[model samples]
Target: MLWGKNIYRLSCISSGMSLFSNLMYISFIYSISAKNSDSDAQGLVHPIRDPRLLSGVRPGITSSQGTSLQGSYYLRNSYLRHNLKENQTGVPLFLTISVTDTNSCSPIENALVELWGANNHGLYSGFSKSGSPSSDCSSWLRGAMETDSEGLAKFETLYPGQEENRSLHLYAIIRTDWYEHSKNQTVDSDSSHNAAAIVQIFFPDSLNHQVLNRTDYKITGRQFVKNKQDFIFSSGQGVLKAKAELPKSSICGGVQAHVQISVDAHASQNITVTESPYQCKTNCKAYQNTTEQTTTISATSKHKPHFIPLAVIFFASTYVFYG
Candidate 1:
């Protein structure tokens, strides 16, 4: 979702209050913005409810290289580059991506789901430095996971903070190798239960208000913008919407984001995976076997180190255990 050259501000829409399951309330989500897209709520598994699992996961990415990143590009092998701490800043966010066959609505197991989001202060891990975008790299909030037997992949992360004209959102890309096609390439006869789609999940105004106002998130002294002001939102139609079932007992509270992706069986060419936004190494194979039911992330190379300030580290530890 790049604008012009590098500006990738997606959109900021007031989250709709449409309720999903009884255990969950709508937070932020995509509205399947494609024309003639299916409106049916689709998923291949039961919603998540385990509190321990919900809180134990640590999600967030660090743009620590303190380098300026180009306007927009897809992050590669994101699952391994993040940390696994439970106490991250801002509101704790848990997300689940469900994959299913377009025809039967059956779950697509082992599908790789890659995710990346900016911290509460509007900086992305490994992509932004000292509050500005960078080409240098770091890792924490960026990562990936695979769908389980039930076609579900979940993560522990935080609510997205707004940047520039865009609203709070997370970037997602579902990758599968069954069929290959490009905008200029024709769809191969190859067919499989898998399909790939790029999506941006937005937040609810009610939730955005809560997260943005928190002392931890507000420390940046940033201004808030609405969906109407965001170009992607104002100009686009059929945005996808997501709902969450949050735990009420934790200090900052934990949430289970239940999101469903829709695929068109016949339109293999149209639904084929989009190219990764970031440039890949010559043979940039992912560090982990993306075909597993569940996967944890970590960096492969030990060199090319990045640094996080001690003050920020101290504040993070305090926020997680003492806040």
Candidate 2:
């Protein structure tokens, strides 16, 4: 009975995990890059100082959602608990974005990136503290990638689901200066020149509906282009659009839901060399003194405003019954 109760509580705490978890893990990446002997080959990547400040309107095209529905996991309860290899879905979708110095037009090989989003069913894959049965809560859906001198970084996972109010999104947090040859480096003016973009990628409204059901996803906007859709994904026109639509495949060994879309980043942009090419790590003392420390505010506090008191009541109920 005690063991059963413990398991029940564990399940309750993490009924689902989402892309938001990736946002919190941004501070933990340590700087290290693979070494190469050639001087022409070896390059410097600057640490980003204030990532949020570099933002403008998100371009209509992006590298990354907000989501509603439950998805079908092919694995049964028996398979879910102990053995997890690849997700039963065939190959989870993979997307790569190359970080470049705007001036030098070179790869920002050491840029650190954190990414997260919902699964195809519109649920986030990893959201909380419970141990994942089919996989570790800290598994591969979200991860950190360092760019190569070629200025490229890649991630492999499934496409996200569309949720109400929130549009489809892929949230990413990037740290500059955490690259090869530049470990533990401070952000000098030479390295502090920040030029990075956090843009969203969107599917055509027709395709979005086709993936789920047309009746469910009605087109609300005025114009339709072969490529254009979401305002968040409007920039970097050449690199951001999907090359082709992907057909459905398996999630694991089991059959996966039909896949309606897939994309590859093929656009090339000019990168400029900077006085400094990388941003300093946020945890670094020099960086921290200059940067504002962050604190968590409840999402509802900004929205519903009265959510804190209701949350307290909910917590009290949990303490009385489950505690």
Candidate 3:
């Protein structure tokens, strides 16, 4: 009777231990998956009080011309302009924008997506302070395109250079309706009714450091602003940032960024264009002036740790206790 009781007690203890170990392993897996889902999931709404919008230039009446001098305004109605890689001075950037409706979380088709940013020297195409014509006549780094059925708008352009107070960024505007711009109207005009969302796109600081170190960017001698230091970026949280995948080989020399923007298509959020800290200064003549070194970063591999060790340990402990 005593030996039989010992066997029964051992069986119960082993069952309990097995159950506890299984629960612990399941909890660990759940926590990791939840964290990853939060990072990869889309649908975060971008804030409207973007300080960078203050420099938003109105699209010129013609595709070839830049913004008007009346004041800076967001570009619209420049659909004819595509492929913003005309000047191609810096590292190539392949940008893809995915537009989704905040209400239904469905992809929005035919949304007008306008993108504008600075060149290798940190100069905007239209604004004179950024090295464009005084009349704001050059439109090299600005273009507009409509989202396709999948709500994707792709742009082939150079990686944006940094400004004094601003990190490397690209400005984007999504509109559902087409509104005609008055000849004298500025971006400050009440055009929010038609605008779905006005936001800025950002890159990772690690990638920025790598790209800026290249000869094309190093010649500018301008200090780059990190995303953490930029008020506009910090204010938007992580919603406005794009996920960049750097090129692994010299043959594929450009980087690709993907971002999904969620907006209320029917509702108009007030997007006021206020003055920004970004100045219209030319690039600093200072240059790091080093031989361009190519550094390749391999894509991060996702290898799950082997869980067999845990099972083996559990079995060994069971055997020791039972024996």
Q: lDDT values of the candidates?
A: 0.48, 0.35, 0.57
Q: Write the per-residue lDDT of candidate 3 for residues 99-159, one digit (tens) a residue.
A: 8888888887766677888787766654544433233444577777667778799999888
Write the residue-wise lDDT of candidate 1 on 1-323 in tens digits. 34542332211111111112211211111122221122111111211222111111111222221122112544443433223223347777877778776877877665556677777777665545332333345545666665678878887778876675677777776544322112112111122222345566666666676677777677455577675665555545324457866566742775667788854322332233323344332322332123321112222222112334445544544454334
Residue 112, model 1, lDDT = 55
RMSD of each: 28.4, 25.5, 21.5
In candidate 3, where is summed lDDT lowest over 10 consecutive residues? 286-295
Error of 3 at 323 (Å): 99
The full ranking of all candidates by TM-score, starting with the best, is 3, 1, 2
The weakest ten consecutive residues by lDDT in model 2 span 74-83
Q: For candidate 2, write residues 197-310 as lDDT tens digits.
A: 323444445554444442232335412233344444544332234332444553222212211111112222112212111222323232221211111111111112121233
RMSD versus native structure for model 1: 28.4
lDDT for position 225 in model 1: 66
How much does candidate 1 score in TM-score? 0.52
Where model 2 places Cα greater than 4 Å from the true spot, the runs are 1-91, 125-140, 179-196, 213-323
